[model samples]
Target: MKVAALDIDGTLYPGALGLQLLQALTANGISDKSKSEDVFKVVEKYHFNEIDFQTMATSAYTLFAEAIAGISQAVMQCIARQVWQQERTKLFPFVPKLIDILNSQGYSLVLISGSPDEIVCCLAEEFGISKYQGSIFATHQGKYTGKVNLLSGSLGKKYSIFLQMIKDWRVNLEESLAIGDSITDTALLQ
Candidate 1:
C-alpha cells in the first residue's frame, strides 16, 4: 500500500506537539516539577531562538522522561486527548482537507513524530489514520518506567527507525508522499 508519511508538529499544526505535552503534564500536576523551572527556561530559550530545536527537544525529553515515570498509561492517554482538545483549534485549515484527500485515494496515512506516543494516537485518530510511530517512554504493566527512546535525533538514526517501522519501503518512493517541516523528518521524507 502507498504510504502518506506525515509529521505532526510544524507540518500538521504550527506548534510543537512534544512541547505542548510537557506543558500539559506540568499544568495538570501529572509531572514532577522539581526540574520544571529549569526545563521551561530551556523551552523559553528555544522560543527566543537562543537555542536550537535539538537542544529544546532534548531538554524537554529528558525532563518528561523523569516526570512521567510511574504515571499510568491510561492517565497519560486521557491527558493526551485533553491536550489535543485544547490545541485542536490551532490546527491548519488545509490539514483536514489534505488528510481526507489522502484517505480517499487509499494512501495509508502514517505519522512519524518526535512527540510522545499518547499525543500521536490522538493525532492519528483525528484523521482516522491507523499507522504511526513516535517517541516512546518505556512502560511496564501500564506504568511508565522512566526509560526513554526518542526519535528526534540524527537523520541516520531516524532513517533506520523509519525502515524498521515500514514493512515495505522500497516500492513506495514513486507514489508515496511525505510531509514534514524539520530536519528531524529527513528520514521519513526520504
Candidate 2:
C-alpha cells in the first residue's frame, strides 16, 4: 500500500504547534511565562536563519518536558483538545482538500510530528487520518514522567520510524510520498 508521511507543523498548518501548546500550558498554569518567552525568542531566531530546526526543537522540547512532567494523562489530553480547538482556524486552506484527495487516491495518511502524542493523535483523528507517529512521554501511574521519546527532527530517526511503519502497515517505500516543510523531515523526504 502507498503511504503519505505528512509533517503536521508548518505543513498542514501555518506555524508550530509548540506555541499553542505553550499557550495552553500557560493558561493552565503548567508552565512559566518566562519559558514561553524563551521559546518565542528561539522561533524568532529560527525565522531569520540564525538558528537551525534542531535548536528550535530542542528548546521546545525542554519547555514541554518541564511543563508536562507531573500532569495526569487525562488532564494533558484535555488540554491538548482545548489547544487544538483554539488553533483550528490556523490551518492552511488547502489542507482539507488535499487530505480528501489523498484519501480518495487510497493513500494511507500518517501524521508524523514532534508534537506531543496526545495533540498529534487528536489532530490525526480530526483530519480523518488513521496512522500517526509523535513524541511519546514516559508515564508513571497515569502521570507524565516528563521524559520524552521524540521520533521526529533527528537524523535517521524518521527513516527508522518509516521502516517500522512499513512492517506495521505493509506499505511500499517506493510508492510512498513524504511531505514536510522543515529540515527535520529531511531523512524521510530523502
TM-scores for all candidates: the values are 0.86, 0.88
Steric clash pairs (candidate 1): none
What value does the lDDT take at residue 54 in candidate 1? 76
Give the range where candidate 2 is weakest over 10 consecutive residues by summed lDDT: 146-155
Candidate 1 segments whose C-alpha is farther than 4 A from its true place:
47-53, 152-154, 168-170
> Candidate 1, residues 1-190: lDDT per residue as tens digits?
6778888889888987767877788888887777555667777887899988777777767776777888898998898899899898899999999998998997877888877888988988877877777889888999988778664443445566556667655546578888888888776676
| lDDT, candidates in the order shown | 0.78, 0.79
RMSD of each: 2.3, 2.0
Candidate 1 global TM-score: 0.86
**Cα shift from native, residue 119, model 1 (Å):** 0.6
